[model samples]
Target chain A: MSAESITLEELDATERFLLAIADDEFVTGQRFAEWVTVGPTMEEDNVLSSLAQDEMGHARLWYELIDHGRDLDTVGYNRRPSERRNSILLETEHTDFGDTIVINFLYDTAETLVLEAVAETADDAVGSRATKVLEEERYHLEHATQWLERLVSTDEGRRRVTASFERLLPRSADLFAFDAAVGTAPSTAGILSRPTDELRAAWRETVEETISSLPLEVSADALEAAVSEPVTNGRAGEHTDALTALLDSIHAEGLPADHPASGYHA
Target chain B: MKLEERIAAGQLIESGDELTDEYRELLCGIIQFTANSEFMGAFAESEWIPRAPSYQRKLALIAKNQDEIGHAQMQYQLAEDLGRDREQMLTSLLAGENGFGNAFHYPADEWIDIGLLAWMLDGAAMQLQHSLMKTSYGPYARIMKRVCREEEFHIRHGEHIVREYATGSREKQERLQAGVDRWWSRAVMFFGLSDSRSEKSERMDELGIKPKTNDELRQQYFDTYVPKLRNYGIDIPDENLYYDEETEQWEYTPPDWEEFNRIVTEGGPETQARLDRRRTAFEETAWVRDALEAYDGTTANRFANNITA
Candidate 1:
């Protein structure tokens, strides 16, 4: 339904659902942008840079849909960690290029799946937005897939990337664990029709299948261990200290009082 | 027509074979320096991406620095097409055996320095690059066209930030002033030596690689930026700086060439630090590149990968 056609409950649920997606994109983009000028090669650096900016652009699009009267920068940078809604998988510090690659794969894969769910069941406005976001996400997945193959081709690359997968994949259990955030309101309001568990299962299958092709081994047992762990999630605004540090660092320089981006922190 | 005849007729040289050895050497040097500068420049300011004052600022900073890297990629490819090796250029850059702009050799001490970098340094580069859009080499001129287009955004973004700071609180204005004081001399010498003191300008002008002499570009940079900074209530570092109405020239205290040569030939404050960062990153990621090379560069191999997501 269009904005005029949709009931208030639907609008509220839709905004809640998309806010989580936007937060994920924004945080992921911030992490990705950290790769600027430091990627393995100039070509790869260019690609990562493009990916970073694309994510920020995606975040802005989602924010625009739900910001009410706030500007993008306010909605993006001014949110406290406790208020943010993103997977804990994405909030970790990127200590290696391998970490970036693994997270890129996991994040883009989960995003594509969930966005597909949104596109399939959401109102026309959101469905079209999801469709648009997926168009850009298609390249991101391709990048992830190609890099995963090449990175795993070597012993060192495989070991390092596997280590990243072990650490990061477990955190990804929170991707579809959004029930605590909006509490099935989106699903109930029909803003999202796919059952959460079904989405989680599909995501795990795709990720496992992708890893199965490579020589590298990620402990599937560990991923499942985290998945079934009770309420270990970021969707309910429970984030790791990593997100706290990220917020502090970004706000460290301190925006000027009159600066347009200066939020409550100012 | 002969290469010289084509150049003399103001024609673009599209092919490498049409060049004399001197022309090729000069063109190669110019392109190499340009490509190296882009990479190094991006490196110098790249760390600020995550720490930018705001989300919009962060995005803008990333796009700006990212453009420098993209320009490097394009220019390196252009250099390769002109008989230079991209890998060797990068290797030399990390090895401390290459030349790039003087501005990048220094650190951006404060966030305000980033503003000055994009505002003044990029502004100065754009002055020279806008002129290079008319360069005699076809590939380089074409690259400059796209490069200048993107550079316009950097300068505009910088100007916006600088304007805000200029109109902002007392503390913000003071920081902006300090950044200008630190960067002003470097920006002045950004054009390198004046035509009379430089050996390469006349030759470059003769070959049409760089049509504008050092003084000309510097003058243009001064004309645009001097008033802008002063209007913003920031101080210019040089007291002797003035426009010569009689001679139709901008005059300023010339940068200490001895200091310029020392920093350029020896190294600047951040030269070793930034280069080490690149070297370490390059060494660490050598495996990824080596692995791809093993498969004949399957890094971007589209359909050949086994993963299906």
Candidate 2:
């Protein structure tokens, strides 16, 4: 259905879904930025930093589409961790280049699937925004996939990549764990053309196929275990210490307490 | 034509061109030092990216850091044209076999120091770089034009932060003043020693490799910043700092050349830590590079072919 035909409750559901995506982008961008000066090489350093900027830019675009009245900083920095809706996977600290690549791969793969669904939505605002974000997400996926393939070629490199996948894959559950309202409202109202479960399934197929192609000893049982694991649904407001600590750090640094509401209306 | 004859003619030397051994060494040394400074400077500033007080500040810092990295890339490419490989230059830097500016040697301890770095340190750098916009080497001069343009925005960003803190709460003002006190001497020393003490100054000038003496650049820096800092109520740190009307110059207590030599040569307080971080990153990421080298090139070529198809 077109946006004009959707009920107010359905619009609210769509807004919540967009918030989760924006939060994921903002938090991940902030995390990626920590590598600005310290990337393995100058070229990689520049590329990663550019990616961080792009992610943050994507977050701004999504945040603008919501009915929230807050500016980007107000929406991004002023929120308490408990109020945030980003996936727990994004908030985990990266311990190595391998971890970075894995997270990038998983998140970008999931994001691409999610954006595809959003692109088919009848809501013109979300459909158009998804189109713009997908253009950038394509390169993000390419970057992550290229690095993943390359890193898995050597024994030691393969070890790191495998370890990162094992530790992170379980956390990928929440990327698709939309709440009942957000999960069904859009699709039921015909605002979204695809169900969240279909997008989730597509994301899993892409991720598993890519991992299976890598020259590693990852087992089918481990992959199955990761896929079936219970999820900490961030869309329903559940999060981990990582997001809490991130928000605490941001606040401790003295960002202004009163962020003017963006007065944004979809 | 002879090197000195070319110098007299004021002609730009193109890439892949030959010059006297002395001239080539001098040019390479200058450009490499500059490139290293850009890299090290960005590394130092990256420390504050996470701690930036606001989202706008965080974005600005990251953007500036990226610009510095780009500057380093351009300078390194120029140095490569002059026959220096990046690996050798970077390895030498980590080994203390290469050197950069002294200002970067000191720690950027707080947010105020970041402001000081952007305003004063970068301000000092711009004086020298602005002069090099017409440098004798064609490639280096062309790169400097771009570097100078980005640097202009950096200085404005820095000045905005400085002004914010300078006019902020008493605590912020105190921090800003303290940051200035710590950095003022180093900023003055950034231009190196007086012309009379350095014989290379005259030779470099004659070669047209250096168009202005260090003392002249230092004075120009002083002329530009002194009034600006005073307007912000920042003390210049040097009690002896004064303008000589007859000489049309500002004179101040010279920086501790002994300390400058020691820090740049022996490494400063944060130098070892910063180098250790860079070394660790380089070593850890070695596998990534190795993996790329070992990967089959045909795979990438095939992927591209599929795209075109």
Number of the top-ranking candidate, with DockQ as the measure: 1
User: What TM-scores do the predictions have?
Assistant: 0.92, 0.90
Per-residue lDDT tens digits for candidate 2, residues A85-151, read 7888899888898989899989999888878877886467778889998998888888888888777
Model 2 bad stretches (over 4 Å): A1-11, A180-186, A189-191, A248-266, B296-309
The lDDT per prediction is 0.82, 0.78
Candidates in order: C-alpha RMSD to true structure: 4.4, 5.5
Tens digits of per-residue lDDT, candidate 1, A199-219, equal 778887888888888897778
Off by over 4 Å in 1: A1-11, A254-266, B197-199, B297-309
For model 1, name the residue pairs that clash.
Answer: none
lDDT top scorer: 1
Residue range with the least summed lDDT across 10 consecutive positions in model 1 chain A: A1-10
For residue B129, model 1's alpha carbon misses the true position, in angstroms, by 1.1
